[model samples]
Target: MNFDKTELSDEELSRYSRQILLSDINYDGQLKLAQSHAVIFGLGGLGSPVSLYLAAAGVGKLTLVDFDSVDDSNLQRQIVHREANIGQAKVDSAKQNLQALNRHIQIATLNHSLDEAELLTLMESADIAIDCTDNFSSRFAINQACLQAKKPLVSGAAIRWEGQLTTYDFRQDNSPCYACLYKPGSHQELTCSQNGVLSPIVGMVGSMQSLEAVKALLGLPTLMGKLMILDGYTLQIRTLNLKKDTHCPVCQAQS
Candidate 1:
């Protein structure tokens, strides 16, 4: 992607003036962000904030995948949709909201569950894949697809007052896949519907995921093999360095 500094018009300059103020993201960085594309799974709580922030930050293309529709319970954290959006596909609502947030961005909607085949197609065009789904099935599928595609996967989860963020860059050889941290179908887990989640916690984690995605796109250092855990009640954040499990099923198979 070629970036010409003079191509930014006065309107774009004013629009991204605040981002340009940051030394980390000047004209060059903004151009990189504008040229990059991301695929986000799930358009619920975590996905709502992730997509919103990414779109607002002027990512060139965003592809949203979700099989669900708007419900009354989603209004608390799914800020992309409203009361009128009930029964409407979440991806459709998210596309409309994202475009409204940034007209310069291109929005694509996939109103279907991400099976393995669809995952590969999405990752082919995406610079990064974000896992915001609440279930392990979808998360594991995303991880395997990212690993096969050699793409960076930014995964985030939030429940109640706790949130977690991690990056699995399979291109790095030793980075841990999502299955390395948690085995799929090995143990039972609760979903947001069963366990419930705090509204703001979803936003917090989703925003962090967006930040990591931007950093990865800009070639900035990020949490490639580390897990960040946030505690809303104590307001404490912990970073745990995770090593690639040589005996792990997924990573071992890949090796």
Candidate 2:
């Protein structure tokens, strides 16, 4: 039901044939994915699914950033790492898994946190950045990099059975950047270690993040102007329209 043999090789046509079946994501759309680069921040619960899906979908290049090493605890939800990778750097572990999924694409790893200048440099070559980090500091940093670079950022967060998804298309004149929604250092940080999270909650949110990233890469319209929240306990989801904060310290200057 997907693309026929014209634009792609028999092997490639067979690999992503299923997705190419969609009217909106036919042969041309697959080509877009084949030519794009994505940089992802963090490689934990959320990053696990996001990276895996993007690789499977044939995103041409991926740069994974994470300084943490895997532990026995992460095995429960961080599905990309194996028991053998328990002490390996997260980016290293993730690179192995993603490369194993699709040897045709490129996977690069950075086993360290990026400072502002470093992030901006990485974002410059990236078509989009995915924020799969856990805390506000990393989130705010990634947001700043994407906004400054005029690239799209697909962000997902999950803690204690609740999750949220949103994208900031810095290309848009009035799109609400992440800084408009949450101020840095204003809220106490939350961690899964201190406050437990249901495994599936992160999987759901992270998968949504991957979808948003793909849509942005393809120049397709998505939940660019709304925030989606999921209540894992109740199994209900809500999407709320977001308004740009004219007074937001970070976004205000951009406006």
lDDT of 2 by residue, 87-164 (tens): 999999999888888987888889877889999999988899999999888888899888988999998999998999
lDDT of 1 by residue, 16-69 (tens): 889988899999788888888899998999898889899988788898989898
Worst 10 residues of 1 by lDDT: 1-10
Residue 209 shift from truth in candidate 1, angstroms: 0.7
RMSD vs true structure, all candidates: 1.9, 3.3
**Cα RMSD for predicted model 2:** 3.3
Question: Which predicted model would earn the best TM-score?
Answer: 2
- Stretches off by above 4 angstroms in model 2 are 1-7
Q: What is the TM-score of each predicted model, taking all chains together?
A: 0.94, 0.95
